[model samples]
Target chain A: MNNPGMTEVLFSLILVAIAIAISRFWKINVEKDIAIGSVRSFVQLVAVGYALNFIFDLESVWLILVTLLVMALVGAQAASSRVTKIKSPFVLILFSILFGSFVTIGIMAFLNIITFEARYIIPLGGMIIGNSMNASALSMNRITSDISSNRLTVETALSLGKSWRESSALYFRDAVTTGMISILNSMKTVGLVALPGAMTGMILAGADPLDAVLLQIIVMYMILMAVAVTSVVVVELTVRQLFTVHHQLK
Target chain B: MGSPSLVVSHVSKIVDDKKILEDISYTFYPKNIYTILGPSGSGKSSLLRLLNRLDESSSGEIIFDGQTIDSYVVCELRKKIGYLFQTPYLFEKTVKDNFLFADNTVSNSQMLELLAQVHLSQKMLESSVEKLSVGEKQRVAFARMLLTKPKILLLDEPTSALDPSITEAFEQFIQKITIKENLTTIIVTHSPEQAMRFDQTGILIADGKIAESSDIKSLLENPQSDAGKRYKARELS
Candidate 1:
């Protein structure tokens, strides 16, 4: 398949046009949103493509690390904004995403599954950070809502001479499970349901079918591990803030 | 009496610039049942919470056993000061689980004994708490709290969900344990009749201050403070 230039990209806007047409015809009141979203997505992707081109050309290890840090910060901000109970969840979210993503990446490098080059690290780091961000957000949100809604349950345990950790142990399991549920479901229905992004992109880029499948499998496991670690870390940090040093609910 | 097992010196709690408790001072003696009587939202529960350090006082000192409550490890302090909620909460599953949750060292024999004290049968221990009546659950919660071997017990409207018979029985059970275990038992009740039934020293809280503190009969009949007179006249509720 020949790599079509700007014309193909422009032609894709026809699909966006059709979406806007339908939204307007049905009086969904989302035609403006769809149009704006389409334009935003186009601009963001194009900008990312150019940036990646420049970074790949530079091939600086420090530059790659800086990019990952920036991505994690941006991802953390997006996750923390979704949670309203906690006053400032940004630092914990950032730490969780960084810890979860880098730890997996570190292990992958140690096992020689991937190299330290910009090509491999940046893309895989992006995937890891993105998934971990979602997991952290989901876990934090679930635990907060669970604890707040079930104050009697939590306080009962506390009044029974239990520590904060013991009082909320059940909630931790629930919230972490909630965080990991998506990945678990996706893992179960991976190829059977639909082609995931990484594998589909690899195949479209003319990689061998088996190679794409192998990479996709690695990506799936990486996400599962990252999500697990991130959710647990974020939930632990978040729950600590909900109680005082005296073990009282705040 | 008995060197004041617990003492609160000028305790006050302010949340969001609203006073929940103000300059509350009290001395709790061991082996005595003290009833805290108040109307709804009068900070009866808030007073109990401060004793157990479930909620911190804004400006005050709580001395437990000759030392400030802050001196003891929080978990150990909580263990020593057991609390029972108004709507009794039992962990899902058997009554035995609830007992074990309070104190993992609780034995089957001990569980059975506490259950018996609460007027529950041994068979009920194995039964799920969800299937038990509200009164039964309150008794189970009472038994479980006793399992911790606390030095003090804070009962927050513990019999609110019980019938007349059960409430009487539960009150008698509480009286028995306070004497038997030498526990400083503090019970919070909104009803003046319940306080009279206890026939103990009563602390009347009205608008976050101690309205009266004396023998329940004297406090109810020959009242002193304005709030106490209003309470006797059936006006504060």
Candidate 2:
């Protein structure tokens, strides 16, 4: 399969033009956003492509790790910006996403399911970190909202001699489930509803359909594990912050 | 009636640089019922919250059973000094679940006995808490609290939702249990008549300070402080 040239890349702008045209027709006032978003994504992806080419050629493990950390930091910052209830949620979010992604990817490398090469680790690690970041943010938001709104329920349990963990256990479970619901639904209708990005990309790049399907399955399971671990870790850390050592809700 | 079961010595609670309670000092005795009467936002509930360490005090200390409340394990302290909110929050499920929530080791027989004391029927245990009336929920909450065998009971407008008949009967039940179980009962109420019903020691607080602390008869009948007189005349809350 031949790599796409500049002509093919320029042809994709027609889709953006159509989107802008629809926005104009509807008077949605989003034509500027669509134009800016298209330009920004093009620039970002081109930069990333060049950076990845450099790192792949160098094949330095330290450089790869630093790149991953930078990605995780960016993801954490993006996630934390969405959360308003808690103070300084960045450290906890970063820890959760890093731990979840590292553990899942490390296990796959250990099992030789994926090698520790730059090509495999960078892309796979990107997927793990990206998924884990969303899970962490979703769970953190869910637990904080749940606890604040249900002060009576939590304090009632506390006043009845239950510890902080016991008082907020229901909200903890709910937050974890909320974080996981998207991936769970994706798993249910992965192939039937729409082709997932990994598989579609592989198939589009001339890989065999069966091989693409197998890779997509692995990606699905990897995302599930990463999301589960990240969400649980985030909820655990968040709930601890909601209460004091004296078993009182903060 | 006995040595002090709980003591609030020079306690104050300041929130966001605003004083909610200030230099509050009081001694609570065992087997005695104390009515905490004040207008809305008078810090009556805040004072009770301090006793159980629900909210930290800005200054002063709370002593329960001869030890500072902080000295004991916090969960243990809360268990001993049980608090019931203005509207009883029953955990979703059957009535028995709430009992088990308080003290899982409580036997069915013990639960039945406590229910009888609170005038709840045996069949009510299997019923969902949502089906029970507000008065019944209060009793369930009260009985569940007793399962912990608290030395002190803090009731925050426990009967505000109940009708007159249930309020009178519940007040009697609280008084009877205070004597029978030797629990030091501190009830926060808005109505002066409710304080009169308790017919015991009364603490009248206004603007975060205790305006009157005396027998129930003198507090409502012949209040000495201006705050108490204003409270009596329904001019201040």
Candidate 3:
């Protein structure tokens, strides 16, 4: 289980070469994307590897917090970009991902389930933020569209003396359910249908198979809880955008 | 004898710099049918929305039963002042479920009575709302409105979907309920004949203003204002 050195890594270029060659033969026209993607992945991962090495060496709490904040900002922007209809998705997305990622990390660190070190926090924070980002974006988009398209239903409920919360309750539920479906499906099919990234990465990095399974379980639970929080927060903030204070549809 | 059931005082609605309703004032008394006759864009629906606080007015106040509308909780205000839209929206569930949506504690016998009042069979309660025809859905919506025991009812073209025959029967059923329940009913309609047939107060709205208000017959026979005259002319021709 020796680590793959520079030669082996450069040899992986052949795989990308084969993909580009096939695309060229078929005239599929994605050769540029394939080539750029291969080069981009190599650069990004190598840069991250060096940066993480420095952060892990430092072990400064402030440095970890700063890194998490930067990740949160980028994650929020990426999440907000997916929701086109919302008025201003930045604050909602930022707070949601931050809340979901840090809250889970905070609880884990408090209980000593995961250490406060850079190696554990950074990777785990990335997982939590990544899941929450997807969940927030998806839930926000679904809730906004559902409430807008079901204007008649929402208004009818409002007219029936139902509060705005009660009026959009169904859509909120549907949106959150949609956001968490990925996590739920992954949870159900874990270890059977697929070996997830964290688990596979752990195994490839020479961790014991049992240890990888244990870490994967923790990651899955962390993702589920984070996604749930993100979905709920985004739905709350996004649904309010669709109505006036007077309970009228915006 | 007492204060009117509902009052819209100097209410105006503006959205996105466009005036939807302006400087409209009216008092709706109990146990009377007030037909709000207007052109397509005359703010009939907007006015109805403001009454129950579904949409707030940009200026002015609405007093419901001697208390301002905003003073009451919004949900309770809507229950006290029910609204039925032109194209009724029923939750995609059984008729019984739709009824329960308004007041979950509604008794089965009360539902039966309300349906009977709207000329609907009690057996339809078990059936899903999707199975009902448009006319049936309209009647069910009417029945649902009654379930709240609202003192004021705002209807925006409730019969717009029904055929001539169903509309005729609906008119009769609605007139009966207005008198029997003593509900202050504000109905918006395109047809002047329905307004006249109801034989009650008529308010002619044009360009978001009340052009004229009087007994239905007098207003129909002799409208004095320019907008009223125009509406009468169009109705006749």
| Model 1, global lDDT | 0.91
1 against 3, candidate with superior TM-score: 1
Q: Calculate DockQ per candidate and list them.
A: 0.84, 0.85, 0.79
Residue A4 local lDDT, model 2: 93
RMSD of each: 1.1, 1.1, 1.8
Encode model 1's per-residue lDDT on A95-117: one tens digit a residue. 99999998999999999999998
Model 1 Cα shift for residue B155 (angstroms): 0.7
Candidate 1, B1-237: lDDT as tens digits: 769999999999999999999999999999999999878899999999999889999999999999999999988888899999999889989999998898888789988988888888888989988899998998899888887789999998888889997789888988888998888999998877888888999999999999989999999899999999998888988
| Clashes by residue pair, model 3 | none
| Candidate 1 positional error at A114, Å | 0.7
| Candidate 3 lDDT over residue span A1-250, tens digit each | 6789889999989999999999999999999999999999999999999999999999999999999999999999999998898888999999988988888899899999999999999999998888898899899999988987888889988988888999999999999999999999989989999899999999999999999999999999999999998889889888888877877788
Show the lowest summed lDDT stretch of 10 residues, model 3 chain B.
B228-237
True contacts kept of 2: 0.73
TM-score, per-candidate, Cα-based:
0.98, 0.98, 0.96
Interface RMSD of each: 0.7, 0.6, 1.1
